[model samples]
Target: MAVTGGLIYRGIWKSSKRFGPFPKLAVAGILGFAVGKASYVGTCRNKFQQLGLEGGPGSGPWSRRGPSGRGHRSCHHVFEDCKKKDQVAPAGEA
Candidate 1:
């Protein structure tokens, strides 16, 4: 992103000559990184919410972790849990 921004500033933006290219390049790189990180976090949050695994503290994915913090279940496990919760027996059945 910094490289691209530098190229654009040097090659196109004639008005940017006063402040030079470094500032624009730096701004572009920082903005790009921040936007990318935010996008990734948002995507994960949406996916977890959709899977009903983001209810927070005692119910969110983090709740499944072990004392060593290495027992986290994969998405498959969460999906299976969802399926089980959604299954229903007939009215006459228990």
Candidate 2:
């Protein structure tokens, strides 16, 4: 879904194809991706929260590394000991 949204955004904002620069398109791609992802994520999260669930984070997902020594995991990710797993990423690599 984000990829589709990104394509739409890229067409609208990058139609100019930048002017007289080698890196202009690269810059545009970077900016377009940031804008598109932020907008898409914000919209989806807002819509989900609007459903009126209790105490949901703004991302509709929690972060790992809770204040407690016990780790936390959002629906989007699994819990793992980051300190111990620094040598290798958690399985299913996002």
Highest-scoring model, TM-score: 1
Query: 88 in model 1: Cα distance from truth in Å?
Result: 16
Q: 51-70, model 1: which lDDT tens digit per residue?
A: 65544235534466532233
lDDT scores in order: 0.58, 0.52
lDDT of 1: 0.58
Candidate 1 C-alpha error for residue 64, in Å: 20
Model 1, which residues run further than 4 Å from truth? 6-10, 15-19, 46-94
lDDT of 2 at 14: 41
**Decoy 2 TM-score against native:** 0.31
Which model scores highest in lDDT?
A: 1
**Pairs in clash, predicted candidate 1:** none
Cα misplacement distance, residue 58 of candidate 1 (Å):
12
**How close to the true structure is residue 17 of candidate 2, measured as C-alpha lDDT?**
52
Q: Which residue runs of candidate 2 sit more than 4 Å off their true CA positions? A: 1-21, 50-94
